[model samples]
Target: MRKFAMYGKFKAHPGKGEALAEILLEAAEQCKSVEGCDLYIINVSEDDPDTIWVTELWNDLEAHDASLRNEDAIAMIQRAKPLIAGVEPIKLKPLGGKGF
Candidate 1:
């Protein structure tokens, strides 16, 4: 299966970083049960508390779509509406592994 990844800069509202992180982490856990989710993670910037990022891997584009349609995802996004300032993610398609 082809690997799909998403990398992004999520700017959080003032005093909402921790709360947004919580929702992201929760979604990560919830996504494991998703049909095609391989990996989901959230990373924070130590130098910038208002910044956060995510790395997600899915089996395919279809799976990625399903993950986005999941109830948990919808819920999480809703919960995060007030906590986020801006979300701009860049999606990637993996070409090959280390030996490629």
Candidate 2:
């Protein structure tokens, strides 16, 4: 199966950086037990503290898609919506990776 990856950025609303980060962290933890989730890393931008990044690796594109339909993911998205000012997600085709 082909590996799939996603890189996402979340810009927080004013004064909501910490809150947004916490939410992302919680979501990452929730995804830990999810099937096909290879990696779910949460990061905060040094250049822009209010900007958060998440990089997710999955077994395949279908695995990634299925994750979105999970209850934990749905709840996370709803809880995060108000604090997020913007969201950008990019899908990737991984050739090879050390961690993956």
Candidate 3:
């Protein structure tokens, strides 16, 4: 099966960037043990502290979708909801890369 990838940006409420990032980091850790989770990276931007970027790779699209429905993921989303001002997700078809 082809891999599934997503690049997303989460904008946090005023002064809540750090908190939001922390929560996302927790989610990353949880992904480590999840089936088909290849990568879950959290990044911070120096120019925009309120913007948290996530890069995810899964074994397939179904795996990525299932991860979203995982109980832990659901809880984390709820925890993050209040702090999230906006979200931008860009799905990608990764042809080839050093990381793959």
Q: What TM-score does each of the candidates earn?
A: 0.87, 0.93, 0.96
* lDDT digits (tens) for residues 2-88 of candidate 1: 777777678999878888888899988888777777677899988888888887777887888887787778988899889999999
Model 3, 23: alpha-carbon shift in Å? 0.4
- TM-score (C-alpha) between model 1 and the true structure: 0.87
Error of 1 at 47 (Å): 2.3
Q: How accurate is candidate 2 locally (lDDT)?
A: 0.89
Q: Which stretches of candidate 3 lie over 4 Å from their true place?
A: none
**lDDT ranking, best first:** 3, 2, 1
Deviation in angstroms for 100 in model 2? 1.8
**Residue 38 alpha-carbon offset, candidate 2, angstroms:** 0.8
Model 1 local distance difference test score: 0.82
lDDT string, candidate 2, 2-28, tens digits: 999989989999878789999989988
Stretches > 4 Å off in candidate 2: none
Tell me the number of clashing residue pairs for each predicted model.
0, 0, 0
Q: Candidate 2, which ten residues in sequence have the lowest lDDT sum?
A: 91-100
